[model samples]
Target: MGKSYYYVEVESLAGETICLQLPNDLQGAMRAYRQAHPITWENLL
Candidate 1:
């Protein structure tokens, strides 16, 4: 079985929740998520 690293939950502007399981650490997950959806950053902060 694979190790569980980090779980990231991102909600979109359209009111959809997206879930992702990241193999990297928290920092890496955040970076990847931000890169994938820069617009969501504003809502997160």
Candidate 2:
């Protein structure tokens, strides 16, 4: 069986929207997004 992939849409500080292919579920995708971006917990809300 093949591993499932997830699409994570993220925005950069430059205002460019990019789609990332993550090899994980929603929780994993969120973790990847937080690692790739410089956003804090406070910034999320």
Candidate 3:
């Protein structure tokens, strides 16, 4: 079976919290997430 990912909603200063999926390797997802949402570093947490 393929790997499964878990997600959780996190609050950010931007306003609406987001549901993030945790992948086995975060590098690619991190890149894509930043590109899709241009939030500050702090907002990323």
Candidate 4:
């Protein structure tokens, strides 16, 4: 297999703070992360 590079950046102020290091397909990683950790009212704090 060959190595590939991908870059993804979203303005932090747009939503919650994410400190994840996603090296895979950004869309897929984000989808999985959101599915695993859905935001709730308590998260706002």
Candidate 5:
């Protein structure tokens, strides 16, 4: 099987959902998430 990844919902600055799942690591999922969805999203849900 493929490597397991974390799941979550990404929210945008306009209060809209951009996508689901960030797939970050213990070091910094938020960091990964931020890098992945830069300029489009503002928060995670």
Candidate 6:
């Protein structure tokens, strides 16, 4: 088994951070964040 980390979701500038249990799959979270945030391919490099 792997260890668990924490995930924080910030909706607004003044919004409180929503904490959740982060599974070992970081790729999923990155993908989800990329879709939600305005991230470019170049920035990921």
In model 4, the worst 10-residue window by lDDT is 2-11
lDDT of each: 0.66, 0.62, 0.66, 0.50, 0.60, 0.56
Local error of candidate 2 at residue 37 (angstroms): 26
Q: Best candidate per TM-score, number?
A: 2
Backbone clash tally (model 2): 0
TM-scores of the models, in the order given = 0.38, 0.40, 0.37, 0.34, 0.32, 0.31
lDDT of 1: 0.66
Query: Candidate 6 — worst ten consecutive residues by lDDT sum?
Result: 1-10
lDDT of 3 by residue, 1-45 (tens): 643344668789978899988665875676666668866633775
Candidate 1 wrongly placed segments (more than 4 Å): 23-45
Per residue, candidate 6 scores C-alpha lDDT tens digits across 1-45 of 553344555466787676565565875766556667755732652
Measured by TM-score, how close is model 1 to the native structure?
Answer: 0.38
- Ranking 2 against 6 by TM-score, winner: 2
Q: Clashing pairs in model 3?
A: none
Task: Show the lowest summed lDDT stretch of 10 residues, model 1.
Answer: 1-10
RMSD of each candidate relative to the true structure? 9.0, 8.9, 9.3, 10.0, 9.9, 8.1
lDDT of 4 at 7: 38
Worst 10 residues of 2 by lDDT: 36-45
Clashing pairs in 4: none
lDDT by residue (tens digit), candidate 5, 1-45? 645455656688999986566534442755566679987545554
